[model samples]
Target chain A: MLHVTTGAASGPGREPILSLRSAVFGYADRAVVADVTLDVRQGEVVALLGPNGSGKSTLVKGLLGLNSHLGGEVELFGTPMRQFRDFTRLGYVPQRHTLSASVRATVTEIVAIGRLPHQSWWGRPGRTDQRLIDRALDLVGLEDRAREDVSTLSGGQQRRVLIARALAAEPDVLIMDEPTAGVDAASQQVLAEVLARLAAQGTTMLIVTHELEALRDIVSRIVLVGEGHLRFDGTPADFVLAQRRQQDLILAHEHHHHDDDSDVSQAPGVLSTPHGPLEQPAQKRGVES
Target chain B: MNTLTTLTTLGGLPELLDYDFMRRALLAALLVGIAAPMVGVFLVQRRLSLIGDGMGHVALAGVAVGVFTDTAPVLTALVAAVLAAVLIELIRARGRTSGDVALAVMFYGGIALGVVIISKSTSSTPANLTAYLFGAITTTSNGDLWVFAVLAVVVVATTWLLRPRFFAVANDEEYARATGMHVTALNLVLAILTAVTVVVSMRIVGLLLISALMIVPNAAAQLLAGSFRTAIRYAVAIGVISSVGGVTGSFYAETPSGGTIVIVAIGIFLLASIGTSVRARVVSRRHQRAEHHPHEHGLGCGHPAVAHGDHVDYLHDGHRHAPHAGHYDEHDPRVHAQTADESETAAETTAETRSS
Candidate 1:
């Protein structure tokens, strides 16, 4: 479970695991997340924190090629993202089970699927593949329920299975989309502990989450996004300070801003102040969106 | 009437193998039996169950084109079905309409066009057209068996080889693509396979009844199956049993083979549903008993984590625990409606079934 595997080696001249320069992601002809640039060094746990629909998930999907890339260059493991073909080097955990409609695979079968890209079209898993799958289940502490249908698992446990499936690939960088959304507290803590263990073992991670409850202690850096813009890229402590500053700015400019209660209360992080110091947190408002 | 009685008296199991026509019908049934349901299980899982019906109508149009041109019906059906499959995929990828809506439009349009073409064609007789639409299993030729054999081999080999990829794509399309799976190509391949399967299976069950052969057995199997692998196996078993039984039953009853097979499959589905619901009720009762006596473990309970209550210690960091703790039971109605199979399996075995 705590194997010292090679992570994004970040010393002196080591290249970043993922680099996105002015990346623009969207659907059809519109850009949802525009001109975002960031670099993820090896073994560093980065968290993308934002209110709903702030493009944090879209940015991650753009890096993984799941979203439409309107413009910009993305590099993975020092290779161009488009040209990079070694899929086993990277792993991704999607938001939730709602998207997987027809899948009724057993826990073991779902975990075993993590080994698909590593094997040939018709070849069964080798001994090493089996061992990795087993280790992944053990890592998630789900080895006892390997044969149960994935639908049978609780919400939090299902999230763990997804993480286990990603870990089964033994990837260098694990990118997760809202890994703890709707998860119970106990399961979230277990997930936090598991991820912390992975980070300690030199695993690179990029997690997209709106809530910063269980992950507060584990994250090395935080990236704040709002209204399709990269608002702040700094440490967790700095992120808290920036929030306080934004709150103060909204209070000072209350009469001039003339925004609604929710909007004034939940303005975007510091970087988005260019938009008249009143970036409408439309998504966070309970009634507006 | 005497001759009919004679045939019925002689129509035992061995009598099916005696006639060349019956032998050919049985061979075609066996091939269609395994291929259709195997493909259908994936379709059902993907929520594309009606795609089979859509492809069947497209195949009927191909048959009409063949009748008009005096060409091979099966070959023309293959072409039309493949084109229609590609068209459906195109409409689906456009994302303007829901998949079900797109498929419905195509389904009705193809059948309507086929009917117009058949009515306009001079060479097509009413008898022949009726046979094509409803199926004439007694007229199945050796050449038809060869076509079925080739289709069966292609469908089985491709599905088996790409099993993992199919599962991944069906399970989560975005995650599969993120994992570097060529999802577009795989989707096209799956559509093509479905088109071919639908076209070939049409001969045994008729274009009108083809989707039943594809959907009903798998739906029943999903209800009864313990896992994905077992679902496939169970679907195949149900398919084979129902088809062979239907063919045999048809000969004795002097009924249409296609209709008989579909009806028998439905019967099996009803039986499976009844059995599953009964089991669900028993499991739910057992769970209620376990809930009352918290310390006493239920008989045959398999959820080890719930049993040990290990997760109760999980809120160590002052994280708010779920409001519904200590209520995780096999028969919990909320959990039951989500998946009844979990409760059924949990009520029957030790936890070791999965652990080992």
Candidate 2:
């Protein structure tokens, strides 16, 4: 696991940056992420992990207000999500490079767009904005390619350009859908180093990722979801140990059954359950596990 | 006959400046040429290039309404086009239908309704409609010129002021929304601007060919431009050249001004296609050479001209000095490091369930 000190754990007075209270969120027809209650504190790097179709991304989208809340409440920076206007305080990096290949923008131009929320109406970028943009580019090590067309860059370089764009906003809390998807191993290591540096600098981050290989070391907490429910929310080490225990239990159970002499047909006759419990079988299984 | 012979005898260009009709037509062409392509570049970038055509058809219906109700066609066309633009935006926002589908429904419906409305009006003859459809520059009034000039200036100014914001919204709407931009409002503003530009451009290129004015110049410019700013400049240049040349040629050839202008724009697009393809080949070759022969060279050197930006200051400095210059290797440690983070993030983002 990665080792990094973050502000959320270090400071006793750390405030919650975003909170979702029993939030039920989804499209018009259905609530995909239901009854989700999560609080992200300042200077914390929280990773959302889950299997496919587990509503982890949906919950994150709900927190971002991309999906409307069917019920419950969501707040950003202590204000209600709907009323929150300090967007510059929260930077967002989407899953992929959504820009079409036909776009005629350069890396600097793309990064400069991150300054939009901070800019005044009809105002161009001043010295401060330029400095922030340059700093962001420098952070991602893309300052040298600032003038190159974004389409000319490789996928990984383009991803760095996007991160630079998000960083240019100088956000207090950065929410990335997935910052390392489709990237090579070396890039992941660099990303971890950059993120480690940012964590040390006290910039909070909420990242959603499937694999915990590189990020397991940097993240302060892991929030896992399964089947639209919050399955686990704890430290990275605890989550990893619990995951290993779950696998070990399943393997041991399979081994024990294999060693047993009784056939499956005879076991079914011997182990009988009442029909009344069928309605809540999944819930019961969840509790037992 | 006398004017045509006079135009032909006196060098085919200078004598045309003496006629009032020719002067008005040329001015109208010049204004629409600059304005149409300017707005068109943004529309094309936004992937709504057909919005201009849809609005033109809507304006045609407005002209028919004006003819039927005994009102100024231009004024009524402006009103209808703006209303249609807003409607298009609303429909697009609903996400029930694709943008192109919505535009097609509007374009064909408006033109069909226009034809029906014109048939009902005794005063609206086929010849009169044909003039609106194909453009009769000789009939362009001073009032038309003034209105076109003012609207053109407004469109150009608004586009310039909101260029960066519009590009942001156009490039990645979700990102723009996350950044706290009122994306819907910006889109509405774009729609209104497109509507106004379309209606005014209709005066020169006519409804049937207005889309050509909006899309062709921008398409040609995109093939050659190094940046959006340069694209706008190139698009406007192509627009002015094509429109003015077409108008002048129409006077000498005695053909429909709008049709001639569209033809010229197509010819320019063809020429740009060749230039773009040749440049693409040269760039690929340079990339191959760089990959094979790894050497420490300045950023501006060894790279193809297309790869070098239009920044004159950078070119002057970059050509002389090598800053962090290195070999072009796909497997560079830095590249691998960058790729690892990018793919992991992408994979993670796609791993979980999404609602919308």
Candidate 3:
């Protein structure tokens, strides 16, 4: 489990860094993610939670200006994504790094792509590129493997390397889609620390994960998305409270389920006449916070 | 080895450097060397190797028509080839046939039309016929050299200017389109470049081996080079060596000049493939050993309590973490057999239950 420390507000108390207003986007005719409205404020880490086949990836892409919208608007830093690419202000860490293994690229060379927007049309990367790349490497705890081939590293290390690449761009907001998807426990911890540091630096983040239980502690806001709608949106505490209530309801049903199982064990044997009741539930729930 | 020796004997050809024949051959090879691989990088990346093949045949037909007309062959070939390329692009958009299949259809149609034109034309002569199949340096005058060099410069410059769109489409077209890049427009540009490249390189690669030049150089680069930029440079390097060697080697050998260049390029390609095979073997062996041993864990399984990421393990935890821990022994023969036995037993029970 990751320990994400929450601190006092910085800069604006509640200025939206990333916003999507009633946005609708997906394949033609059939919409996968529809009417999705979200506002991620400065210094906030929003954890999006959902079941499989959920619209998490679609919603994120629409907000990042990587996917076309059927309707509605997505604004980054108050300006719409359609106006200009705004490539410098936004950083994207895709769910999968679409790099081929045959090409031998080092961690530094890969990270240098972050400075692509800033460099002149014909200019090569200079000292500033080196400094930013080094900082990003240090941020991800992969500074020791700076010169190492990116493909030679393990899956977790590769994910960290991608994060480093995105961070090297020095964007105000970092959008990561399932950052810890294929990482070991130790690497997940390291990733959490890096994200924590970025959040502290006032970089707004929107993270998508199926691991809702683990995400509950770190997320300032939890949005439950499914079937082209924002099903639930609230603070992490409220989301947890709702989850607890759901657990109680499920537990109550579980008691009845176990009683029926025991009845199967009893079969035609009758001890019911003396007890006066046919069955009794084993667990008492809906009594605690 | 035989080809290199023949090419190196450029000095023994009775003061060949001063001769116009030697200059034309050298110029043709040098110009094609710079241009072929520059267009080749995109062709190989797009997996449209056979598009070059189709365009070459189209150019050959155009050249044949030019020969019979007693008109300018180079200009006629260039315009006709570009038109044929646009037709190939249209065919691809319709998705009726695979690119290779389309190339074969075009290739046969081109040859049949060319043969018919030559048979009927009274203008067909020994000089006209010689330059048609096996390209000759004697036909490549000073005017041809200027056209070749200018075409090469235009191809290289236009390609460099559109590098980002080229790179994006080459990597993934659907993704590129989503980013608002006009992918169809970019694809048309690549096809036009292929057409232009083949026409300019006619004197060097000729009609038969033009595709080989485009594909071979990129294949060499793919073996050892790491990035797209490095691959382009490596491919161009191999292209230059073959062009310089093939054209010069023609001064001595009885073989067709285009054949010699392609063969040299193929030799380089063969060496690169061999290197890649050895590398794959080493990589797979290490991957196998890693799979067989749990002690060789590269990283710890984040969910320690979960033995395997089966349905039950996922059900046990409230959080569904997509883990990075690679399965160690999933492919062991003994384990596989046991699993087969277990599944068979479950199947038998289900059958018995159905009967009941």
Candidate 4:
């Protein structure tokens, strides 16, 4: 439905919309993620992948100024993070499960919240806002459910409502945290299609996801994090190849130890080395591809 | 029998309105009815239903200050309540202590301070304090009505004008902040608005029972409303009915206004709860009856079958019927018309089913 208004800087050679260099994010004085360097260019769909507590969420929260920006040279739209005032350029869809169950807002009411950045403090929804809200709902295929209470919707439908809410802002980059998490397969496919449509319309996206299989066709790049560190940055094909090679190595190592009685003692070390070597081959495969 | 005789002697609603004091009390109650629940809806949405009670307690201290200083209690209460509101919000924003801890301290401290201050005052008796605590709505002066009117207007206008922003913040503070909303400022404004509501309602509903007026009607509304806006509308309606009815009943029965109003509000809440359960039963019974069918339509049954979510829906007599959990659910075609793409799938499935 072409709901997202394409930004002017949607081509190659455009300055990165979000840039983080030696960034440290945490709560209070403790750094949960440190020394991370990443750049998200215009029109690129980047999937942030990591294990639990890998600090991927912390990094995304840091970008939104939600976490403690302990030490960082983060930039949004070429403006320094601290100096950036144009938040309307970014749309955030938090985890669907995070939506408070107590709220009795309707689908339309929640979607209308996306327009707040563009609205004056005291202004009501104007004609333009309503049209955009409608288009957003249409894009997510939720136009008919606009009047229904959000709590009545299934987990997946609620996620779409959140996506529609984000899309109503017409942001330059849509940042989602585990949009597919806890969502059923059907809803995941629907979300993938919605995201793919947005990507085709030249909208930039930074999605934090563990289910890369669902978004394999849409994600342009993959960023892997482990132990609060950036571990891998490459294309989806490279990630797959690297993952296969790591599995093959583990298999070969297991075969070598099949007859050995002390294999259990060395298993932890062998598994720990896989993450370190994952980066080299993935980067090399990126060049080959 | 005594109560019935008193009611008869007091005459009707028109006779009650004949006295200036009764007129003032009713007008003040009407304003409280409108404003309290309007603010209460947001508080209830945020799950801060007891914050109003805390603000009311703090306002009691303000009334004590007013009495001790020979000033208007409403004005002093407003100042004290607004200050307490701001202080509590700042404490919450600091995140050093949890919100409920702060609320508990404020609630107990406020009433205790008010009682202590009142005990030391030689000019006013404990009876005067009782009037503020339990509410003597029948004794409302013209000056008090004017204050209530102005404060009510402020509460209504601010809430109406800023409803969207308030809802956003209350729903998801982080999302609102990410969207560049001045969340802290909005929260402060809401707290201040809540304080204003407390002061505005305290005269008619009483400081001790003001929270019930703010919360009970909204709670009742939530039982029946399908949306936030509707919940608000319903709550306001319930608030008005309860407050006005309570005031009138109290006038004839010679009972405490605050207790009467709160009881009426609770009564409505109970009725709403019962109504919701009854309606749910009726809807489920209808669904059970509609689920019956003479024939089972499935694959190779000579019916156009469309693949729905987890089951296949067979088109029979122009209605899509899907077997679900041993019952044939009559699927609404209009709900399935979510997108042209889905409808295309349904059409293709129907054609494929017929051909096979």
TM-score for each of the candidates: 0.83, 0.82, 0.73, 0.84
Best by DockQ: 4
Off by over 4 Å in 3: A1-14, A101-109, A143-150, A182-193, A212-218, A249-289, B2-7, B64-71, B83-135, B160-165, B172-188, B226-230, B272-356
Taking the tens digit of each residue's C-alpha lDDT, what string does model 4 give over A184-251?
67667777878888888777899999898888888878888877878777677667776676667666
Worst 10 residues of 3 chain A by lDDT: A280-289
Docking class of 4: acceptable
Cα lDDT tens digits, model 2, A1-289, are: 2457443353544457887788788877598867677777776788887667778777777666667678888888789887888887878888784455554777888899999888876889999999999999877766667776777765556777788889999888888877887876756766666677677776788888876777866887777666676666667665656556544544555578877523332222111112111112222111121
Show model 4 residue runs off by greater than 4 Å. Answer: A1-11, A247-275, A278-289, B1-11, B96-99, B288-318, B321-356
How much does candidate 4 score in TM-score? 0.84
- Measured over the true interface residues after superposition, the C-alpha RMSD of each candidate is 6.0, 4.9, 8.6, 7.4
TM-score of model 3 vs. true structure = 0.73
Superposed on all Cα atoms, model 4 deviates from the true structure by an RMSD in Å of 6.9
For candidate 3, the iRMS in Å is: 8.6
Clashes of 4: 0
Chain B TM, every candidate = 0.79, 0.78, 0.75, 0.81
lDDT per model vs. reference? 0.74, 0.73, 0.65, 0.79
Q: All models, DockQ values?
A: 0.38, 0.26, 0.07, 0.43
User: Where is the poorest 10-residue window by lDDT in model 3 chain B?
Assistant: B347-356
Question: How would you encode candidate 4's per-residue C-alpha lDDT over B1-356 as one tens digit per residue?
Answer: 32443365356867887899989988888889999999988888888888888888999999999888888888999999999999988988887747768778888899999999988887899778888888887658888889889889989999988899999999989888888899999999999999999888887788999989999999999898988889999999999888987888788778988888888899889999999999877645544212454443435457787766534667766667654333455555655666434532332223111111
Please write out the lDDT profile of model 3 over residues A137-212, one tens digit for every residue.
8888666556655666667677777778778878777777888776666556656666766765656678887665
lDDT of 1 by residue, B65-131 (tens): 9888889888899999999989888887776848668778788888888888888889877766666
Candidate 2 C-alpha lDDT tens digits along B255-338: 888998898898889989998899767644433111222222222334322121222111221221112122231212233234
Tens-place lDDT digits, model 3, residues B284-352: 553321112222121232433322222111111232111122322122233323554442121111111
